[model samples]
Target: MEEQRVNELKDPSASKKDELLKRRKKQVGGAQGDSSGTASQGEISPEEAAEQAAVMRSQIHLFWGNMLFERSQIECKLGLHDWKKNLDVAVERFKLAGASEADISTVLKNHCSNEEAAAGHEKKVEDPISNVVDKGDN
Candidate 1:
């Protein structure tokens, strides 16, 4: 329901949110959640795994990313600087959503890494400061 609302309003600027929305189009389940655990329990297919991964990544992104979730009912919003705390809550949600243990494991990597951000500021082609003309001198 929350995701659907997020999807409907659709803040199209953020790259992370864009990716998350794209994944939502392909999300599994009957509008419920994710896939369940193991072959015995119910093995998650590749597509389901991808969708579940996206959900985890999306939740983590929303929590730690630049976006403010003041009205968001997402569980991760309460998780501040605590990736484990966020992951724990997300895991339980996914479990209830029917995500398998292996599926959860696949998305359990450190989602808080800054690798998504650029390594350094992109240098402008020409330094604008250097091009400043001294009109008074002229």
Candidate 2:
């Protein structure tokens, strides 16, 4: 159930995120503002642009989520570290697999940590402390 919730937060549909990103890309890059105050390269309105920008802003989590999806194989290949689990390896894999700093941070701190902890294999047990037994005078 928790996994389902996380997945839902991450938005499992790549295309939905992609479409938003693609539109954002066009808006930020290709869809430049017209000096003459008219739609130029794209037919998107200012209101639409604003809306897309807002949606894209909200959807930024998707970018990192998508990055995780892309690098999951590479991350798996790096395997886990005793101390850090696979996160360090995963982050490196992500970098090698072409993720940005922002992407790495988001993936590690946001998408992966809870899942890793909840998986329960990595639980650290506290070391047993020695008890000082008092010797009573006979």
Candidate 3:
């Protein structure tokens, strides 16, 4: 009976394909929490809207690139040394591409190593006790 039930199950790929389709549909329909409408709904004039859009776009670009670099650094600190080097290279690329020092620092704050940070810098890990498991047989 179990074998029959398993055989009767839908193909995993089909569900995955459906999920991809749904994601595409959502993207096309202006995904939830998207501020495109909110930006347009304001009493601001078209010129103001255009300026706001440009500013938002710039912010998003910086944010996305920073996120990628910081994630790479975290991966490196967790023993992925190669990823760390790659992230450093990416940061250099950003600097060469004219990314502001403030932007770089803000993004890196979350992932910097003790040695990478200045004196008196420390990372505080919230919920450290959650990592401990009580394996005592009671």
What TM-score do all the candidates reach, one by one?
Answer: 0.25, 0.27, 0.36
Model 2 Cα lDDT, one tens digit per residue, 108-128: 655443566656543432222
Evaluate all candidate structures by whole-model CA lDDT and list the values in order: 0.44, 0.51, 0.52
User: Model 2 misses residue 20 by how many Å?
Assistant: 11
lDDT of 3 by residue, 47-115 (tens): 646655554554454445556676786776687767766567656755644465765565456555645
- Output the worst ten-in-a-row residue range by lDDT, candidate 3: 5-14
User: On residues 28-81, what C-alpha lDDT tens digit does candidate 1 reach at each position?
Assistant: 333344344322324456875776576566555434422222212233444446
Number of backbone clashes in candidate 3: 0
Deviating ranges (above 4 Å) for candidate 3? 1-43, 85-99, 102-138
TM-score of 3: 0.36
- Output the worst ten-in-a-row residue range by lDDT, candidate 1: 65-74
Candidate topping lDDT: 3
Residue 84 of model 2 has an lDDT of 53
Rank ordering of all candidates by lDDT, starting from the highest: 3, 2, 1
**Of candidates 3 and 2, the better by TM-score:** 3
